[model samples]
Target: MDSRDWGRFLLPYEQAVEELKVKFKTLRTEFKSRDEYTPIEFVTGRIKRISSILEKAKRLNVPMDKLETGIEDIAGIRIMCQFVQDIHRLSALIRARKDMVVVYEKDYITNNKESGYRSYHIIIEYPVQTSLGLKPVLAEIQMRTLAMNFWATIEHSLNYKFKEHLPSDIKVRLQNAAEAAYQLDQEMASIRDEIISAQQHFEDKTHLVSRVLNGIQDLYYYHRIREAAQFQLKFNELWETEDMWQLKELSQELQEALQRAKRSNS
Candidate 1:
């Protein structure tokens, strides 16, 4: 295809990647707001470059005309998790999504590749609305633990540098590194509860601080400088003591105080 045709053809895939990224990021935010553990630590996405697409197409012997159906990974999303088990949780979440339909899945985590690569991949048919109409496109989602992604990233760079023909020593070293990464994930999983609890505590504190700040801002806007200063002083005390519960209670009290002030003024 010409450059113009290629750009036009890639528009839907680009849209799919951007939309999916936003959706998964929203999920993370929702979980944080609820102080719940999220299987997805973070999400990233991209559309395959034209050069990479052409190379893959050539390697796979895919005809240009058949590229749409033949290339399943033109648009890609990577979801990083804190534990191996979270990968399965994310997979289930993806399967249950109404916006995207899962056409196929590969459990590389359960069945690791010979090169020691591991991840869970799902191919989904996502529909994008355009000026013309709704266009259904194929996108790939890869889910893996943070360690697994770290290993895969290094391995991928090596593969590219060596043109997939790595020296024996380097190949062996990469395989060993992959195993070490897997073991690291296992160790993290063993202490998963502690890790999650720590994260939840942090999120709770952050949310409380945000609420307190917003309340203070509202008080200042209503010309309640004294009340706002008092609340700020209490906030500083609770923050210095690291008292999350007390801070939360203060937030609520401030809210009530502001409401009463509003009512009295009204």
Candidate 2:
């Protein structure tokens, strides 16, 4: 096919990618507001690859118009996560969505690819409304861990750099890197509980800091300047600890002190 035919086939896919990006970004914001554990680091989309598209069209003797709808990955989304478990959660999230209907699924994470690629893929029929009308399009979604994504990305780049032919040494290195990525995921999963506990502690400490600052702001309008200065000094001293647990304990003490001061003034 010529350049114009390529453009014609790719334009709808590009639109689909843009639509998915906007939808996913909005979803992220909504999830954050609701305090949901959305582990999607990023969602990326692309049309079916140009080279693949051309090869398929030639083999099938199909026109661009017929090929566009026939190719499943003309529009695709890749969801990058931090853990293997998150990939399952993300798949559930997508499957549960009323707007996006799952058409097919391929669990490459469980089966794994011969090339050592590990990702969970789902193809969904996503309805998008345009100026013309509502159109149901096929969107391929891939969910994988950050480490997995890193390995896949590097492998793809190397393949492209070597013109789809890699030296034996490079291929071995790529395989080793993929193995390392798998090990990294397992290691991180092992510490998942500890990591989550630390995160919760940090979040609590952040909330305590905000509360302390607000209390200090309120005191400026009521408490004596000398008392407020003493309170500020004590908070600064606690802040210097730089330990979330310690800071949290100190914040509780400071809150009690402020309450006592308020009672004494009253």
Candidate 3:
């Protein structure tokens, strides 16, 4: 395809990647705000480069007209998780989503590749609205733990450098590294509950502090300077002591104070 045609073709894929990234990131934020243990650590996405797409199409004997349907990963989303089990959780979440429909899935984690590559790949059909109409695009979502991603990143660089014909010694080393990364993920899973508990505690405290501050701001806006200052001082004390219970109490009190101030003004 010419440069102009390539740009036109890639525009929708680019939009799909960006929109999916935002959706997944928003999911993380929602979980954090609710003080819930989220399996997803982060999300990233990209559109395959034109050159890379062409190379793959040529290798697979895909016609130019069939590129859109043939290239399942024209738009790719990578969801990184904290634990191996989290990968399954994220996949389930994706399956439950209404905006995208899972066309198929490959369980590479359960059945590792010969190269020792491990990840959960899901192909989904995502509908995007355009000036013409709603366009259903095929996108790939890969879920992996942090360790898996790290190992995969290095291996990908080497593969590119060697053009998929790595030296035998390097290939063995990469396989060993992949095994090590899997072991690391397993070790982390052993203490997953403890890690999740600590994270939830931190998120709860953050949410409480945020609510208290917002209430204090509302107090100040309503000409309740004295009450706002008093609550601010209390928040500082509780925050310094890391007293979540007292902070929760203070948040409730501030909310009440703000309501009373509003009522009095009315």
Candidate 2: regions farther than 4 A off: 1-12, 48-52, 55-62, 214-231, 242-266
Give the clashing residue pairs of candidate 1, or none. none
lDDT of each: 0.92, 0.79, 0.91
Q: Note each model's CA RMSD in angstroms.
A: 2.0, 4.4, 2.3
What digit string (tens of lDDT, one per residue) describes model 2 on residues 139-201?
788888989998899988988899778998888888788889899999998997797677766
User: Of models 1 and 2, which has the larger TM-score?
Assistant: 1
Candidate 3 lowest-lDDT run of ten: 199-208
The better-scoring model by TM-score among 2 and 3 is 3
**Model 2 residue 263 CA deviation in Å:** 17
Better of 1 and 3 by TM-score: 1
Error of 1 at 83 (Å): 1.6
Over 4 Å off in model 3, which ranges? 223-226
